[model samples]
Target: MSLYSRKAARLQLNLRKVAVKGGLAIGAAQAANAALQAAFIVILARLLSPADFGLTAMVFPIVFFVTMLQEGGLTSAVIQRETISHRELSSLFWINAAIGLALALLLCAGAPLVATFYHEPRVEGLTMASGGLVLLGALAVQHLALLNRNMHYGRMAFIDVTAAFVGFIVAIAVAAAYHSYWAIWLRGFVTIAMTFVLAWLLSGWTPGRLAPVSQIRDLIGFGGNMTAFSLCNYASRNLDNVLIGKFSGEVSLGLYDRAYRIVTLPLLLINAPLNRIITPVLSRTRDQEERYRNAFLSTLQMGLLVTVPLMSFIAGNSKGVILLLLGPDWIDAAPICAWLSVATLLQLAGNPMGWLYISQGRSRDLMLAGVANSMFICLAFVAGLPWGALGVAKAYAFCAFLSTPLLFWWATRRGPVSLRNLVGAISPFALVAGCCLVVVHLLQRSRPDTGLLFLMELLTASYATMVLTLSVTRTGRSCLAQAWSVAVSGFSMMQMRKRSSYG
Candidate 1:
């Protein structure tokens, strides 16, 4: 073979190796995180009241909005910047710090008002205690972005997994001993402190004073537009919880919040990593429109390959699954979980498209799309409030479905992913899910006495295995081979290191 051909082959091998390592690291980290969180929730659910969970949930959106303000898209600006100066980085850090301080103070001040609105005076103390979480979150924001930009996902994964495990352990311990909402608040507090500590240790970068006055304007011009879009996007995403907490009271909100958490399980495992990895990768290729398009489509296809069947099986067997995981008291959340699964599936579709627009520096397009969607969703919430949380869930799902086309159009206009191609890629998974649902229905009719637990476990396992067998026939096997090779090599290397150390 020619020298050039050999070089090309070597490069391909290296790329595959990197992808495999990254995937494994992310997959392992997410699996660990999910397990710890699931354990925490199970323990907390039994120890604390739904009203305690609801109170915690009610504070989340406000804290989230405050976090958005602190973020102000500066981290993205730092990551996507062609050339980042020390001055600029320091300026960004302080900007975040200042905003965080202000946000904390504001949250503390508004504690009483928030408590009054919720008709629970206890919320004042809860809100005040949770206020510092925003500051902690802001302090770590830019550092985490810097880690991402440097492709230090292995370190990022370590920090994340450690923090989650620590937080979970603390939460469970606190709940078991105290059995109050203090456990929930302590979890947030621990998470923030660990985040700051990890970011500082892992990033190994320190900042000084702000940059030149001129730098601030340019950075904000880019970041401000992105932040505006993020604000709307955050609102659209969290509006249901916002409304639920306001109209339905804390206990109802707790039930719905728990259900929503269950619904986003697949999303937490799959979409979270994609959302992290895709932006920087896409940003590097933003000038190459074809590469950008292909990468977007491939990520979308891969995301759906996992998300679709997972959502389908979970939704189709929500009753049994909820009972199994959350126990008998949460049977009420079963239908809500089912309804939320649909919204999450659509979210799986739309999330990567945000990466596309952001990588292309089309922040205004994202902002506009976000605004339009938020408005429609807010209208839906107003119209659906009379029917309660179920109506709100349906409204949110409907809004998500309506917004899918808008997202598709935005992505397609800028890339080569046709609507037909997108639909075609996901068809097989959809078909499998449809078949599984049919089988479920038939089995239920024939064996009317079949337990919810048996049916849920059977359907989930059966459908998931079918999807994996069909989808992974070629690509999945290839990935598995690469993963196995990597694992074996890593094990061998560790053994050699131990022998060398002894010698």
Candidate 2:
């Protein structure tokens, strides 16, 4: 009675509390995962060469794009739907299983071609390893979705953290033993494989006999549009790596890839956890305009609060961070990291706009926006090819920010969340972030030879600026109070649960 059977009557009554606790649970898990990942990347960078990372980066876009499409976008559909049946879920499960196996074989077959495309012979085998990871991911997507649909994030979080820990131990051990990039690929495979095992165990789900395909036609329709968006957005975001690798070579791609991995850590931390909670929460509240609007805006502000300062510091102090994390060999990645951080800030501004679209069943809009954005970014890549890796970085950042306004208008024009709402929510943080970034950039230039102590001062001054700005404004105070209450309430709720279990 897993996917086919869930009793959600009581859960429907207090989605707010569920969302709040779920966010806290997943947030804590991701924070741990981020720390693990950051350490892994840093250590691996010192042990391996840039070309090692570059080869993996080259094939990842294709593998990741398929990963997004494997569930046929059914996971989010399952979460957002008002009702789903056992038969329908079972049908979706079998469908996912079939697609996964087919995609695995396809990736394995195409590995040689990927190797051919980049003129890098080593990637052929790496792509095949990624195929195994794909198969594991497809098998578990439905089970994980079942858990997500019911907002069982506490259990899911525990499973996720455990998988990440296992991946960390295994990857590092392999890297230490083999001194190869296979360790990086193994990290992906092990994490997905472990998550699949634990998800089935903890998801309390056992798929029943398959139902007729007709029963899930509407779900397929919903998911198909999402799949289209995934395809376009994948091209938009990942094509840069492909372009750089193919034209500028592995060393260039590797440096850019390392810089990118380091700079985008905060975005992943904020986006991944909130995404798990907010999509389902917003989906449930979509019928209530006020509740829906408040939930989306509150989530947007909170994310910006974490991301802006972090991105600003990284963009402004890329040199110090590079030296500290990756050593002198990767010092060349500093400017590339800075530009990528700017692009990330722009990309992140529209991240939650996706929650708005999915909750409102606007996948078609999402797809169109993705296509248009992809077209522009692709042009930017082509235009920058003559200038090598740094040129590509600069061009990508400028084009992404240029395209963001249109994306905002397109995403919010018809929804309950309007353009004005989004602009207002982001403007204050943007202002504060810009000021702090400028201040830090000037200071860093003036003290070019300073060490970690200087980084501390910059961090302190950045947060101080944010706090002062927020403290002075009514809206900022409201947001801070709301954030504080959520934190306190989530902690209290956990303690109560522990006490009840002990009794």
Candidate 3:
């Protein structure tokens, strides 16, 4: 083969290796995170009232939105840049720190306003306590980005899982002692602080003298757009909670919040990690259009392979899952969970649209799309607010379902990825997932008893049916073969490393 051919072949092999390693590391981390989260949710749900969770949830969006500013898209900018200077990074770091401190102060000052708007005095304290997360997050944003830029997912995973575990322990302890919403607030504070400390340790980069302001303007410019996009996106996603809390009261908001979390748990476990990995990988291959497209589609396929069935099962067994995980007190969240499941499923299906925009340097498109998305979502929230939390859930899900096709078309219209490619890639998984949902739904009806044994049986049947269907079809077989190869590759790599260490 020619030198170019040889280099191309090597790049392909490296991509596969990275994919395998990243997937395994992220999978392990997500599993641990999910388990910890499940424990936290179960324990907290039983210990605290829905009002407690709802009050805390009301403050999260505001805090999270401010935290996004601390990040300022600078990390993404770092990851996407072909090359970055120490000075540029230092400049970004200081800027992030400044934003973080400012936002923290602002949040603290605005706490009373938030409480007033919610008509709940507790929100003031909750908002103030959570304000520090922005500064803490600022301390780590760039470090985490650098880790991602270098593809150090294993270390990143370790930091994330450890932080989550520690935070959960603290939160549980506090809840047991105080039996108040402060426990949940403390969890957020602890998790962010721990993550910041660990990220600095693992990233191994220290900021030196700052770069000249003019030198890093391009990086800042890129990040500014990204931050703008995040602001819009954050508003759209959280408007539901804000509106629901204002109109429906803490109990209703709590039900909606818990239901949303349960439904999106699969996405948090799967799509989130995939997105983190894919961004850097795609950035590296941006010049190789075919390779870039293939990498994204492959990642999307694998992500859906896991997420689809899990979501379908959740949708089919929402009541049982809620009953088992959150206990009988949270049974009211079941219907909302079911609706949010479909919304999350559609949301995940369209999420790759983001990978294309970022990897291909389409921040402008991303920002514009964010604006449009926020508008649509806000309208839906307003329309549903009159009916309370359930109304909001139904409206949000309906909007998401309605927007999926439009989002795909818009995202792909200017990128290397096409609407046709996306549809073709997801069609098989969608069809099979639909079939599995139907089967699971029928079985669930037949076993209407929500006992542990019956729920277990339903879950087992759903997964089994999905696997059988996949094994029986050509596309399904291909997906299974691809997954098997990645798994085997990951296993072998682990073995080699172990032997080397011993030797």
Highest lDDT: which candidate? 3
TM-score of 2: 0.95
User: Model 1 over residues 1-503: C-alpha lDDT tens digits?
Assistant: 99976875575455444444565667679889888877777778889887898888888887778888899988777767777887788888888899999999999999999898878888788788766888898889889988877767788889889888888889888898888887988887897789899999999888887788797786787788888887887787677777888999887788888888888878888888876776777776666555556566666666666666667767666776677667788777878888887778778777777776677777777777778878887888777777888888888788787878777776657555566666655545455556655565555556643365666566666556545555545544443354356568556655776899999
| TM-scores, each model vs. reference | 0.88, 0.95, 0.97
> Taking the tens digit of each residue's C-alpha lDDT, what string does model 3 give over 405-473?
888988899766788988877777777678878987999888688888887787777777777878866
Give the Cα-based TM-score of candidate 1 against the true structure: 0.88
Q: Which pairs clash in model 2?
A: 4-86
What's model 3's overall lDDT? Answer: 0.87
lDDT at position 263, candidate 1: 81
Worst 10 residues of 1 by lDDT: 475-484
Question: Model 2 over residues 313-425: C-alpha lDDT tens digits?
Answer: 88889999899888899989999999988999887787777898888888788888878888998899888878888888899899988998998999988868888988878
- The residue pairs found clashing in candidate 3 are none
Worst 10 residues of 3 by lDDT: 458-467
lDDT of 3 at 42: 86
- lDDT-superior candidate, 2 or 3: 3
Q: Count the backbone clashes (under 3 Å) in each candidate.
A: 0, 1, 0
After superposing candidate 2, which stretches have Cα over 4 Å from the reference?
Answer: 1-13, 495-503
